[model samples]
Target: MTNALVIGASGGIGTALAAALEGQGRAVTRLSRADGLDLRDPDATGRALDALDGPFERILLATGILAPSGRSPEKSLARIDAAAMAEVLAVNTIGTALVLRALPRLLARDGAGKVGVLTARVGSIGDNRLGGWHAYRASKAAANMLIRGAAIELARSHKGVTCVALHPGTVATDFTAGYPAHAKHGPEQAARALLDVLDGLGPDESGGFFDYAGRPVPW
Candidate 1:
């Protein structure tokens, strides 16, 4: 049976994605902070990944943080708090980096394996119009860069691995509970759409960013 792994399996999008993958009859393995896979802790993250037996056909990381708890994303340069920014970057960018280090071996080296790194259009430097949420935006942008770089290197070593960034759109989750107006999609719908997007990608499309509609997001 084909196997898949989701790194942020406890989060809103992560749970839905796992269920969807299972519905497709794929053997799914899950890891998250709730299951002792804290991406923020490198050693813990490394240990969790080390336990996994891989050659997975698909690997997705739904990990991210919009901002620290009890605080909103900064709307202006004057409002950017150093500590809050650090926390955002820690979860959204740096933690993912640690997880990424193990991915080269976890995925199929010969068969065409697909990787989806959850990111956002807000992370797109070319799509930025409002220019707020400095830290969250910057962290995601960096994550995109990381994925792009990974795609380039993986194409060389793991020729069949297609790695790219994904934007799930405005899903109604705890993360967006505050902005009720933008809560247009349920997590399940978003997950299915993202999976479809992943299904359509090829090596030529790797290192690109795409939205749930399977359209490329300007980088």
Candidate 2:
């Protein structure tokens, strides 16, 4: 039986992704703060995964933050706040690294296993024409580096492992509620698209960053 894992299961994209996988006949394991897997707390994260049995063929780390609550994305370098930036990095990058620390046990070794770390297109260094959201951008960019490094390390040991950073675009969620975007996808639509993208990736593309459309994003 195919099993899947979604770390931020309570969030919009995470919920949709988990449901979509279940609809595809996978037994989905959902973990969130309700499950005591708080990314902000390293001990909680370790304890939560320790309780799970895995080698899940699909694993999605869907947790991310645009900024800390009561704060909007920074409009200029002057707007960068130390505490808010730290919080963003805590959830998006460092926390993600901590999660990948369990990769050797959580992902399948004998067959194809895929891990998608949700990031953003704005995180791209080469694609940056308009600049703002300093902390969010830096956090995701750092997260992508972690994904690349993880993918490379896993490739030397784990067969058929494809771990990559994914850009879900802008989805209609509280995460994007106040953020005005010219284009936004519904959670379900984004889930299906992201799944499709993941399905098409292979070991050769493991460390690359890609959009929901499966096009490689410039790092």
Candidate 3:
């Protein structure tokens, strides 16, 4: 049986992805802040993940926050807040790095092992036509770099391991509740789309960023 681990299993997309994986007959291990696996605490995150023995074929780090509590994505440079930006980075960038750093030993060493870190199109510097959401955008951009760097290093030792960043597009989850005007996919739809992209990925495409539709997103 295929084994998978989902780090942010409580959120809408995360929950849907976990369920979808299970539905496909993959045994999935889920961890989340609700389960006391707070990504903000690296030691705790390490311990929690260490408890699991792997050879997991797939690991998805689907945790991210658009804004800190009592805050929103900045609409202008004047709206930027250092504290809020820090919070955004804590969850989106730093949290992702922590989870990714734990991967080498957890993934299948002899065969295909896929790791997908959920990022956003806004994170793409070359694709950012409209400017706004400074913190969230910047944090995800940092995450993309980290994913790429980690993928390169992992390939040197684990040739079968593939790590890539994924953009889920606009999803109709509470995460996007603040911007209802944008078209969004339901969590289930987004989950399926993302999994399809992951399923299609070959080692040759590792370390790249792609959208739900499997199109490469410019950095």
Candidate 4:
């Protein structure tokens, strides 16, 4: 059976991705805070991954946090709070890095499997013109860097593993409800596009960042 691991499986994109993978006949293991597998805790993440009997064919990091109640993404740089910014970085960037650091053994090698992280287009330094969500943007940009660096290292050490960062577009989740309606795509669409990207990815495409439509996203 094709084994898969999905972090943040309680979230919209994560849940969707899990369902899609399962639908394709993969046996998926979901990791979430509720399941006691918090990615923020490296030790816990490592333990959870170790608990799996076999290596995973696919690993997807689909966790993120956006503006909360009364908080707006429209806040000016001067209005940004340090606490909120730290929280954003903690979850979006550090958490992901910790997960990757802890779970390298679960990744399949020799170009037969894939590892993907959900990044944002706003993370693209070259694409950030309207900079408002400083913390989120910076965190995601860091995530992209992490994915790329991991890809390079894995390419040399774990020849079979294909790692890539994916931009799932503006999905209509609690995270994006604050944004304008036109900016949102449904979770299903995002899930389908992400799966397509995964299906098309190969070792040669490793370390690249791509949008929901599988187009290259500038880093």
Candidate 5:
């Protein structure tokens, strides 16, 4: 039986991704803040995954934080609050690192699985034509690096497991609620695309970044 675990599974993208994975006949496990598996807490995350009873065939870290109370994308660099920046980094970058750190134990040593994380196009340093969202951009950039580094290490030790970072485009979610209507995709559409990319992943294709359409995203 193929079991899939989805962290941050309560949000629009996460919930949609979980539903899609379930529809594909994989046993799905949903971890969310409401479920008490806070990604920001490494110990809590490790414990939650360990409690799943078996190794997951696929693990998706879909957690992310964009804006905080009293903070908006409209704010300039000088106005960027340290608290909000730290909060975003903790969830977006550090949280992912924690998950990767726990993977050696959470995954089967036999290695026949994949791990994915939802990154954003904005995280692409080469694609950053317009400069704004300093904290979010930096946090996601760090996430991309972590994903790549983890993928390389996993490839060396766990030959059957593929790890890749994905850009889900601008999805119409609470995280992107501030975005204009023309700049967003429906949750279902984005989720479907992400699943497609994941389904096609192989060990040889690991440590790469791709967009929602499964095309290679330039680093």
Candidate 6:
């Protein structure tokens, strides 16, 4: 059976992905801040990941935040809040970095393991059309760069481990509750799509960014 780890498992897409993995008869380990695996706390995050036994077939870092309390995405440069941007990067970019730093040992060194960092299409500098979410977008862009760099290093150090950033589309979760007019997929659907995309990826596709449909997203 495939062994899988789902970080941020308390969130909508994360919860659905965990369920889907379990439903497929895979052994699943779920981690979340609610369960004390807070990624924002590096010490806690490191300890939790360090305790996990090896060679998971798949690992998903599904944590991200649009904005912090009392703040919203900047519509213009004038609306940028330094504190809020820092908070977004803490949870979205730096938090994922902590997990990425711990992933090499937890993955199958035999070149059979895959790791995915959830990112956003809006993070794509070449694909940005209606740019408004400055902080969130910037955090995701940085996270994508981190994933790409990690993938390159892991390829040399861990052989066949494929690390890529994924976009789950506009998921019908609290994450998208602010934009009711946008097209969205239910968490279950989005989770399944992401898994299917993962199923099709190989080491050759490492360090790339792709959307829920497995289509490449411009970086």
User: Each prediction's Cα RMSD?
Assistant: 0.9, 0.9, 0.9, 1.8, 1.6, 1.1
Which digits, one per residue and each the tens of the lDDT, describe model 6 over residues 1-219? Answer: 889999999999999999988988999999887667876688888888887886799898898888996566899988988999899999999998999998878887775898988999999999998978999999999999999999999999887888999999999998788888998889999999999998899999999999999999999
Model 2 / residue 91 / CA error / Å: 0.5
Per-residue lDDT of candidate 3, residues 1-219 (tens digit): 899998899999999999999988999999988667877787888888888779799898889888987788999999999888998998889888888888898986678999989999999999998999999999999999999999998898889888999999999988899887899889999999999999999789999999999999999
TM per candidate comes to 0.98, 0.98, 0.97, 0.92, 0.93, 0.97
lDDT of 5 by residue, 1-219 (tens): 589888889999999999999998999989887766776787887777667655888888888887665577524677688788888888889988987887766677786888889988888999988888888888999999999999888877788998899999888988777667547889999999998998898998998899889899877
Which segments of model 4 are wrong by more than 4 Å? 68-70
Pick the winner on TM-score between candidates 4 and 6: 6
Give per-residue lDDT, candidate 6, residue 13. 94
- In Å, residue 71's CA in model 6 sits off its true spot by 2.3
Can you list the residue pairs that collide in candidate 4? 109-160, 110-159, 110-160, 111-160
Model 4, global lDDT: 0.83
Least accurate 10 contiguous residues by lDDT in model 2: 174-183
Against the reference, the lDDT scores of all candidates come to 0.91, 0.92, 0.91, 0.83, 0.84, 0.89
Angstrom error of the Cα, residue 22, model 6: value is 1.3
State, as a TM-score between 0 and 1, how close model 2 is to the true structure. 0.98
Which run of 10 residues does model 5 get worst, by summed lDDT? 67-76
Worst 10 residues of 1 by lDDT: 33-42
**lDDT agreement of model 3 with the native:** 0.91
Cα TM-score of candidate 1: 0.98
Backbone clash total, candidate 3: 0
Model 2 C-alpha lDDT versus the unseen true structure:
0.92
